[model samples]
Target: MDLADDALRDRARRAGIAPDWTDVTGQARSVAPETLERLLALIGADEPAASVPPLVTGMVRQAIPLPSEAGTGAAVLVLESGERAEITVHPGDDGRCWVPPIDRPGYHRLQLHDREITLAVAPPRCFSLDEVARGGRMWGLAAQIYGLRRPGDGGIGDSRGIAELARAAGRAGADALALSPTHALFTAEPERFGPYSPSSRLFLNPLQADPAALFGQGRVAAAIRTAGVAEAMRRCEAAVLIDWPEAAQAKLALFRALFDGFDAAAEAGGGLAEDFAGFVRAGGALLQDHARFEALQAARLAADPADRDWRRWPAALRDPAGATVAAFAAAQDREIRFHLFLQWLADRAFAAAQAEARSAGLRIGLIADLAVGMDATGSHAWSRPSDVLGGASIGSPPDAFNADGQNWTLAAISPRAMVETGFAPFLDTLRATLRHAGGIRIDHVMGLARLWLVPDGMAPTEGAYLTYPAEDLLRLVALESHRHRA
Candidate 1:
């Protein structure tokens, strides 16, 4: 981020001190585009390797997969930790997790699980090891069948309903079924909307749980539903609104009753529990902790928002130091365990739905969609604040589609940092996304080439294009796409 443009800096200083009543906040002056281009060309040939190496060294782990998109940086890379790097790849034009961080400085001896591999790095650039195949066919469903058509099957469609949909898909000669983002929604809110923007992308939305999917299979008749449970479900589903609160409550209660069934049915060829266990393990302790925080906040808010929210609570309580907050956090943690269990259930349901599509013999099993950004206050931000910049949202300039630019207030990957570090977090996110999905559709696919980065308090017109390493990104994409075969 250093500048060789002395005159530009001088002009900026003058702009800052201008006595003319023009507020410079309205004026963000970098070099003129053409002049900047010329300067870049001139400096590129003459610039010392030392000057450019920092950007490469700044890579979190100094490694990323080669053959990523032709960005200025790595598309994705693997670190020694076997975790992801800050980079991302085009990944077969499908949305799925791509993995990264490579060794930097001299040679790196990597043992992926059991196999030993080696790599070397230079001052500003590093080498990468990529395993890529040409391409392969994929399969999956794109829609959550239950989400559509509010049948008379109470307000919510249970598992039976999903099965019926799967059967229907088979009949229709479709192979796969993709779903809208089914990530859990906040249970407390003014009808928390948008499932894609989740309270926690790692967990499932209990509202989507259909008791009929679990328990109602044997006992309950079609018309007569469980009194308390069904009634809550109806209330949750009745509104024109999404009804996250009523849905959460009804689903949670129904799950409590079904939990016994889940444990008992575990050995009966039902692998949902096991799948969920894998999911929990895959998320690692940090992900679990974040979900626990969501549970705590939701429960305390359920008990009382005034006592729970920082604005109304005592100073220390508002802070993590308050005794009451700790007690509440503990209680909520108990519920978090429940949430984790339910996550397994929902996940099983999701996977089952995918399998159902496969049995139907579709080309793709599940095609998931990834929004470009997430809410700043959400768990993703709370856990990885550095990866996600607050207050600053990701958006785009006005194009032919819409004259007014779009502001996806949700946090986006810090493109520069991500590319340099081989997109570690980005890869993790991709892996989680692609886990169940057979194919992924990255909304605003154009973002991979260049992002219109707008600093806060700036207009869309003032935004500039941040370059990415296109070739490397493409190579990583090819490698990961082969890995997923989508």
Candidate 2:
């Protein structure tokens, strides 16, 4: 190779960008220089010639490297349990430090010289299955939550339907009911419907909520008639496949009417008013952001049917915490409250399903599916833009299945950002999925180690593999798993 090629390859190697890779056919292939440059740009590795070693940020069972300033001195180690200890940092070659065994498993802090670093001490393995199985074979029933059919469902299967299914499964000696992702989808753009491609993994899909569960059958029926969607509902229910647009439209109209009645009842001091108030209070900022996004998207769509993506909206309204967004929330207060109310009902319904399964003697009641990532233009990315990588798409490399490879068009979380944010986004997602379920099935679980990322407008085969902080992510998962007993 020429000098220029050698320099480029060396730079790629330093940035963790593989210059060449072995294909599935056992043939060695070199990555094109153009591909490398584009991929490097997406990751913000502009100074490719800079030789920098990976920084050690956390510690588990293995020892981590330390800076030169961290001399051979006793460092103050603070455990997650508020216990502090002075541990001697033994210096080694290449500016590395040996961290002694931390008996506890938690996020701890280490003080060395003038620097303080967060050290995560994780257990060797996750919660063992034997603990819950007790040497017995457990059986589970996995079903598509949306495909479930039931009377008075108004076309779309919902949490109430899942609850009935759970009861039936429990009676049949099933220990678990695994359901597809219930992640929140785009409320404004119902045409872009796919359970796997959700707007946010941190919230539930309001469409899966049973209006009748909270509003009562009579009230739901009255709302259906009031909204002039009874005929549309009948057509949707009788259809074989889910006509998402039609069903979503009908449901939204009914929900608006139901919300009107609910608001009036709550105004008269109904008991549910206080319950909903507490739910909103508990949801806090995260819930408020989601509700605002929904309302804003709807308002934008109404103004111009072509404007659906938030990225295309006015600049000031794009930021979730900006002054414009806050003002919009205030102006569209009623609309935002309607979205929040739907989420409240959905949460209540899913919680009821899990309760039903457990009360029926099932050890593992509900197993919820957690999609790998969310659409880049969706709420999760908009709300936590820093945590997500821009100008890249999650995809798969060329293989026997598809010679050209496949791009899922999903935005993945940035590994570096996750570390910087102390994995708050990941932790929040895990906690939410575990809230109303006994276990969570992580979609594309292999993404924990590495993700195949393709630069925008590029062929999937030209994509590069991006490494993730696998050990750290797994440790967090295990921690949450133990906390939820999943």
Candidate 3:
């Protein structure tokens, strides 16, 4: 049979699935009887060897539903000659592949039939935040936050305001303050309006830096607070309206004032020691590359954002792995230190708030929202192109709220990649998000089963439904939730 022949062409045609087999078996595009036999046994489709999918081997998303009470997330399977990912049980929703960290980059998988295949299992490990079922007396103030604006904040509250709001909410009934994601937004023109959908989850928005708090002394903050205390209060009252840029500018002022403190801390730690060590340990060469990329970005701010690729920058800064790249990396070392300091501070403050909420006899202080994926142009996509959805975007088919359905341009982790990579990054993301929350609200929970992926260059409506190992993915989530009590 022709590998590109559409066996189910009649039905698949309606769903936008074509017989094209261009990307699957790249160079060594030939089927081997041996590997095919192994795969047939794995999927329990060995009835007639002829029935197995021909070694068209491109990107495979093999999802095998593990034996269980069916519909539960649980499974066991090896990749194209890799470690076995087994989920003994399953969880409720999100029975698909686990999510990964935003900073992690690249696709790590073994090639099969000269193609990329994301292996999947039916009995996939999965779970929800409430499944762990642990609770503490904690209450956090959840609010929408923003940064600078062209109209000078234009009534949108900034990070300085957010910190103060956290302080106020803590003083009130809340033990902590959980604001919208403060991930870095695009610095160029036509700023994106959505906060949940961000430009970069790997980095914080500089708009929220609170420059005045950092740069100005007690005098400057006091000046803003005292001069227009009522105005600031009114601004907070009009929450939900976020102006990213202006808020970023105000926060930068505060950040600049307080930067000395960060400097002092780094100095004490001995020359950006902790952050550098942490990045090396966590992200490996990719992390190093990302940090270096950021440094290069800062130096070449003069260029347009679209043309900011280091390769196209100054002659001295062309190659990402060359001398210019090294110099840029060195310059960014300081910024990296500052970024680490900020994250540490944020974590401690949030954790403390959770603790205080617990003390106050509250239940469910911090409920983190886990997005389905990341932004295409953001840090996460840049790092791991393999794990991320390249020619597709995850979205809804047709829902009541959106008759046309919604096309969330956020990037996604390919199911096939997860099974092959042992779901390492995907599993890590779940572990991280749940760690800080009393509970989590997984957006688009249905993503566990099937994702409507709009093929590259196609309109959202032209995508097809791709299924995953719902049971196995969920079971893994349950396993992790149970293990960590998250």
**Model 1 residue 67 lDDT?**
27
lDDT at residue 34 of model 3 (Cα atoms): 33
Tell me each candidate's TM-score: 0.63, 0.89, 0.59
Better of 1 and 3 by lDDT: 1
In model 2, the Cα lDDT at residue 91 comes to: 78
lDDT for each of the candidates? 0.50, 0.82, 0.48
For candidate 3, the per-residue lDDT at 208 reads 39
Of candidates 2 and 1, the better by lDDT:
2
Name the top TM-score candidate: 2
Query: What is the TM-score (0 to 1) of candidate 2?
Result: 0.89
What's the lDDT for residue 256 in model 3? 40
- In model 2, which regions exceed 4 Å deviation? 46-94, 98-100, 108-118, 212-222, 265-271
In model 1, the runs with Cα more than 4 Å from the true position are: 1-147, 150-163, 210-216, 219-227, 234-245, 259-279, 303-331, 416-422, 456-462, 468-474
Candidate with the greatest lDDT versus the true structure: 2
Residues 1-486, model 1: lDDT tens digits: 346455554433232211111112454344334333332332232233321111222222443332222223233344435554444432433322222444343323333332322332333322211111125433334455446536433454544455566667767766556566655556555255575566555455655644454334554333233334777666655766545555555655566656545555666755566665677797676557555556755665767864333234445444343476567667665566566776665666666666666676655656666666666556555555556544455676566675666665555665444544445556566555666666667666675665554445655544444444544444444444445655
Error of 1 at 450 (Å): 2.9
